[model samples]
Target chain A: MTNLPQNEANDPFVDFSDVALRYGDENGTLALSGVDLSIKKGQFAAIVGPSGCGKSSFMKLATGLCPATEGSIRVAGAPVTGPLKITGMAFQNPTLLPWRDTLRNVMLPLEIVQPHRSRLRAEYAKYVAQAKTILATVGLAGFEDKHPWMLSGGMQQRVSLCRSLIHEPQLLMLDEPFAALDAFTREELWSVLQDLWLEKQFTCILVTHDLREAAYLADVIFVMSARPGRVISTHRVDIPRPRTIESTFDPAFVEIVQKIRAEIAQVRKESKAPARPAAQEQVQ
Target chain B: MKAKHRKLAEKLAPWVVIAGLFTIWQAAIFIFNPRPFILPSPALVYQSFIDYRDPIMAHALFTLTNTLIGFGLGILVGAMLGIFIGSSRLIYAGFYPLLIGINSVPKAAVVPLLVIWLGIGQPPAIATAFLLSFFPIAVNVAAGLATVEPELEDVLRSLGASKLDVLTKVSLPRSLPYFFASLKVAVTLAFVGAVISETLASNDGIGYLMLQAASQFRTSLMFAGLLVIAAMGIGTYLICAFIEVRMTGWATRKQTQVTGGG
Candidate 1:
């Protein structure tokens, strides 16, 4: 493994250096390339890009679901060898088990994660209390006995968020977790998520295509190029904490969104140009 | 409120229809004056049921016992094999074709073989029932496990869950509705298999009783035996259906909504 740079070695929670991923075997398509990223502990970062730009792939690598074909990924100062148990994840769909009720769904991770799994049967009441508290924190107090199918899509997503946080993981990975929700519900959840993040302060990496969402929630936003995706630009938001829907219209916030949009537009243009022979040769 | 009335009516409709059919048959027989041996009226069938009640009860008990024993063993073996095959792609690929081949041969052909291997009594009846009923349980279980959402599996896997954890906690529970559905079908098939073997070789089940009644030209007694078998089939099916509703209420809530809407 290569030695970390001096600053990165100090306090970076997640460090990726020259990371590249190719799907399939030796001659497969390169999904991401030449990526170097660092996120500080407890920082909320967002990755925004055009569709098919490997933003989701980056999240997979960070969580150790898939190995990077090249370079190294370090999360919490340790090399990610396999799936990291310290990370919690949620996706566009709630993905809750239909057979399990909300409380059981929220407690799912506890049944798998260590210390908790061994103690769970003996201390089930305590675990249930913890799950109930998390559910109540997310405004799902009365819905504990409700099945996933019984809940509205937005409510299901809320339960999913609670489930991810129940284990109190060090890192939260969200892959477009609210994209399937309505605009109204989407905005409402932004505050719910923001409140949770404020209270818990877990490190978060949000992969999303919505620039407004990124501008509203993230401490910093990273924009990526089209396929063989690499972070093309990173913008740090200077907005104060506890941002609301009204703050999204703030000129500084709007400017940040527009700047990121412009970067993506530039990426789109570059992607549309006829491919260079050198790039074609490398893919082959 | 209207749905509740409709549900009550739906439950009563089948009995009403059966009664009406029996009434029509009695009227038709009275007016046409058919031979007693050709078409037995419900009255005559009922009389025969009473006259042969002792023997009928004994034979019915014999068939019911064989069916239950065979069905239980089928379930045990079928579920184990189902889980094994469902958990692995290689086993499913290797065993599925052989299962299909075995199921395709008419079970009647196998009844004689079973009789030859194990004499003409409870053993053959039980073996035949097992051979006929296990396939649906295995196939449905495999299908249920195979169709589990990849997203759900990923959720458990990301949490450091082992393969067994995923199966017990997620896959098995997800397959309950399918398992129960197959059970209903398998129970009916088990009855068919038991009777088939009883008709071919055994001397002590509803099938044998009906055969003896036919040889003696006692058609009403034969119809009585048929009615008894049908009743048993429906009873076992209701039990399975009740269990299905209790165990998989989550899976069928949407179906209930659709029915209630209509």
Candidate 2:
């Protein structure tokens, strides 16, 4: 954590080089191709693109949930051959186990990932306290005993966030974690996420459809192309720390959102028109 | 409280329906003074029950023991087969059709075959009970495993959870409700299977007692045996339901209508 910006210039925490993911065997659908991405340690990165783009495929490849057909994916200076132990993932659906209470749901990762798994029983009280503390940060302190179905969509997402962060993983992968929420709830969670990221400073990769969400949370926003998705452009947000909903209206933030929105609109139009319109294969 | 009132009503509803059914049965007997062998009144059945209580209890206990043994075997083998089939797509595809084929053949028809192989007695009754009950449990358990949300699996797998971890923590617990639901069904089917095999070939059991009563034209005794069998079925069903509620109440909490203010 010693001035990571200065030290992280040479060595990246997550690096993908000429990565391509082809589903099935040869001549199958190509989900991603020629995708190269590098994110420094503790940097907040966002990927925004139209629907059907391989934004999610990138997350899978980065976390090693699925293997890449071609190219190399290295996270934390180690090549990812399988699911990495150092990563936490939250999906669009809260996906909390209904049988488990909020506290237990948040503690799920501890039951799997070690040394927490080994130490959990002996240090049960300590871990419960830790889970409670994270839940409090996400505004879920008093509702620890409630089941997932008892909580509303927004609160369930909060529990999901708490669960992902409970294990204290080095990399956090979020795939549209707030996409299902209403606008206001989504904005509130954006702040909740921002505070968590600011405090922990863990390397985060957020795949989002919301342009403003990408601009608000990400340090570097990567706009991907349509299917066979590759990073088309990356924009660095210079907006200051602890950005509020009000800061989103500021010209700097507004301009970045509009620019990315326009790029996504262009990608969406191109994808809709035809599978192959030009042999030129332009790169912006 | 309203919930208490509802619970009381739920507990009494079955008794009220049973009483009404008995009343109609008695009226039928009064309206048509048919021979006692044709249809005995509820009072006559009750009288026969009191007269033959000792033998009835003996046979009832025998059938109950056989039913339980077979039901237990069904659970063990069915659950094991279910886990084996459900956990892997290849196994599921291969064995699912075979299971359906075996299950499709009525257990009553299969009992004679079992009797042929195992010889006329408790073995065939137990085998028939196992055959009848195991299919539902296996199918339900496999369904439970198969229906696991892919997103949940992805979440667990991303946490570096092993296949065993996913199965133990998620798949097994997720299947509990399905297992219990099928238990209620399997228990009733087990009674049917046991009685069918007993009627066909057995030295003891309520089914054999009822067959003896029928041959002797002691219709009241046969009806009494029927009542005992019904009572056993209902009792086992209630036990299964109670355990289901105790074990996996979270699944049916919505139907039970918990008004949690979370």
Interface RMSD of each: 1.1, 0.8
Off by over 4 Å in 1: A1-10, A26-29, A276-284, B27-34, B255-262
Output the worst ten-in-a-row residue range by lDDT, candidate 2 chain B. B253-262
Q: Report how far off residue B29 is in candidate 1 (Å).
A: 3.5
What lDDT would each prediction earn against the true structure? 0.89, 0.91
Candidate 2, residue B88: CA error in Å?
Answer: 0.5
Q: Give per-residue lDDT, candidate 2, residue B230.
A: 95
Error of 2 at B78 (Å): 1.3
What's the true lDDT of residue A32 in model 2?
98
Q: Write the per-residue lDDT of candidate 1 for residues A78-177, one digit (tens) a residue.
A: 9999888888889998989888999999999999998799999999999999999989888999999988988999999999999889988888999999
Model 2 TM-score on a 0 to 1 scale:
0.94
DockQ in order: 0.67, 0.85
The DockQ for candidate 1, computed on C-alphas, is 0.67
Largest DockQ belongs to which candidate? 2
Q: Which stretches of candidate 2 lie over 4 Å from their true place?
A: A1-9, A275-284, B1-7, B116-119, B258-262
- Per-prediction TM-score, please? 0.93, 0.94
